[model samples]
Target: MLDIKVLGPGCANCIKLESLVKEVVSEKNLQANIEKITDREKFLDYGIMVTPGLIVNGKVLAMVKIPTKSTLEHWLEKESSI
Candidate 1:
């Protein structure tokens, strides 16, 4: 299973990113543990200096912006396969 983290404060972008991640995971029928990290201090541990960051399997996938759905799907698919 993939371990996914959505890092950000409780902002619009952060919520959107989290929702999108959940959607993709469901659509793909992927087994993953998706977490939303809202603590500012925790963000630093991921080296995230911006809101709306995405981490998959402990690797940073996006920072500061929400990725396209297709891109998100692709990344999740690739990671889950490993």
Candidate 2:
């Protein structure tokens, strides 16, 4: 399974990014667990300096902006194949 975490302060962009990840995962039929981490300390623990960050399987995939659905889908598909 893919482990995905969204790190942010529950802002608009943060929520949007989380939503986008969900949409992509569903559209691509990815078996993933999406988590939202809003705690400041936890975000720092993940080494996230920017809000709206994406951590996939303990690795940081993106930060600060919502990624395109196609990009996210591609990523999920790749992870699933591995």
Candidate 3:
């Protein structure tokens, strides 16, 4: 299964990103372990200096801005296959 983490501080953008991640995962029918990290220290641990960050399989794929649904889907699909 894919290990996905959405790092943020509970801002609007952060919440949006988390929702989008869930949407994509469900749409793709992926077996993923999705986690939400809200602690600032933990965000830094992932090297995320932005409001929203996306990590897939231990790799940071996005930060600051949310990716388009298609892009997000592509990323998740690529990672799931590996």
Overall lDDT per candidate, in order of appearance = 0.95, 0.87, 0.94
- The list of candidate 1 runs beyond 4 A from truth reads none
Candidate 3 ranges with C-alpha deviation above 4 Å: none
TM-score of each: 0.98, 0.92, 0.97
Q: How well does candidate 2 match the true structure in TM-score terms? A: 0.92
Candidate 2: list runs displaced more than 4 Å: none
Task: For each of the candidates, give the backbone clash count.
Answer: 0, 0, 0
* Ranking according to TM-score, highest score first: 1, 3, 2
Question: Can you list the residue pairs that collide in candidate 2?
Answer: none
lDDT of 3 by residue, 1-82 (tens): 9999999989999999999999999999999999999998898888998879999999999999899999999999999999
Better of 2 and 3 by lDDT: 3
* Candidate 3 local lDDT, residue 11: 94
Candidate 1 lDDT, 50-76, residue by residue in tens: 989999998999999899999999999
Which lDDT value does model 3 have at 36? 96
True-structure lDDT of candidate 1: 0.95
Q: What is the lDDT of residue 36 in candidate 1?
A: 92
Cα misplacement distance, residue 38 of candidate 3 (Å): 0.2
